[model samples]
Target: MRTPHSHNFAGKTRVSVLLACAALLAGCKKEPAAGPVPGGDAQQGLRLVTQYQCGACHTIPGVQGAAGEQAPSLAHIGRLSYIAGGIPNHPANMMQWLRTPHAVKPGTEMPPMGLTEQEARHMAAFLYTLR
Candidate 1:
């Protein structure tokens, strides 16, 4: 008496439930992909941030007493859709922004910290893990 559409929907539901159970039973706890993200050490980046005196202008989460009033809080920077609310929020863009804030956003108040590419990458790596 049931329609073919009902049978199809029930089959789809059963498949979905089976897939979910299989995923749960598999203990899916995969670690994040290894790459530049894992390549750069967060601890090293933390040290660099302090060494560069970034806390003076920005509020960072892990760094001790890094709460500054001049800049935005980077506590959730990883989840931001854009850098400076304009450029795409990718690691490369972040590194460029960190190295040359003025170039990215001319007339901006953020100063150039004179960080090398590698250093900026390390910082970006750390920032991307903020989420």
Candidate 2:
């Protein structure tokens, strides 16, 4: 069962995703960090959020929610709208969003946390299970 409305709806979704990703990529380029470096996993990912000061804005559960920033709470990323350049809400996209939201959606206020690709993927996996 197909309809013109469905096609139009899909188009809008795609457009939104593309715009997000483009914005992200444009904003992703920056100087890498310099340090001894810490471990990276889901636990480390949680720590990384702190290191990157994500809680300063977003209200992720298990992380400090009292930071009182304008960012949205991320208690349930899998069931959200418009992550990863409008890519459907899934684990992969969530991971990509965490790792490189600006890369995925240029001009996003969310900065790159300098997470390794692996760490980002693991964090995304953790985010999906938060629901």
Candidate 3:
């Protein structure tokens, strides 16, 4: 005994319910991990940052006297999806950039920091904690 109007109303209700369910599922999706790199000590990395004088050109949080305006602020480096103008912000890429900025992106403002592999690893571990 349903009228044409009632049939249309039921179809609209079904579509609305389906849309709500899809939105809920999308909201439940997990994000990528943002923890420190393996075998890289965050404390050591912090010390290395100071030792390397990174504060001279970049503003880094949790670091005293690191308020340089020459480079970008590294407050939330961990949550960033990309860095160094466009490179993916993975641990390996971060380490490579820390070791050789010019090689990663020629003509970039970041100069060669002369960091060893282990040092770069430690630095990356520390930088990732900015989130």
Candidate 4:
């Protein structure tokens, strides 16, 4: 003969198993909420530039480049007259370019990157420090 407390515990165990199964079934469903990170790291963005071999094309001061030819560097992007091939330079635009290059220049070689808005800003900040 089982005690009253044991029966209550058994009922709770069954309820827990049911809730677990419900949760397992819920995991089979799909949801749509994939998006870019809200903010980014500029220093990490700069590091990523080197890590992703961007220096091969761009003539950045610190990073090394294997190619004999180098693209215009960001040594002083903050002070430049224009960016994105001379479409008017601004930190926001620079961040836009850093995030989505193709949107700014359709046939440019520079590709979108792994930087966040904050990171791009930080990167812009770092670049401003160059000169």
Best candidate, TM-score-wise?
Answer: 3
Query: Which residue segments of model 2 deviate by more than 4 Å?
Result: 1-41
lDDT of 1 by residue, 18-92 (tens): 776586585533332212453567777888998898889889998887989899988888877786868877776
Per-model TM values vs. the true structure: 0.70, 0.54, 0.75, 0.54
In candidate 2, position 45 carries an lDDT of 62
CA deviation > 4 Å runs, candidate 3: 1-35
Clashes of 1: 0
Residue 88, candidate 2: alpha-carbon lDDT: 62
Model 4 regions lying over 4 Å from their true place: 1-45, 64-70
Estimate, for each residue in 1-131, the C-alpha lDDT of model 4 and write its tens digit. 49999999999988977776586575522321111223544466567666767667776776656242546766665556677667666566666887788888899878777766666665665454444
Question: In model 4, what lDDT does residue 31 have?
Answer: 21
Per-residue lDDT for 121 in model 4?
63
Number of clashes recorded per candidate: 0, 14, 0, 6
Which tens-of-lDDT digit does each residue in 10-118 have in candidate 3? 9998896677658657553243334459989889999999998899998999888888899999998887888977998888889989999988899999988899999
User: What is candidate 2's lDDT per residue for 1-131, written digit by digit as tens?
Assistant: 36999999999988977776586575532321111122324666666666666777777777765264587677766445455346666555666777778767888887777777777765665454444
Candidate order (TM-score)? 3, 1, 2, 4
Q: Which structure is stronger by TM-score: 3 or 4?
A: 3
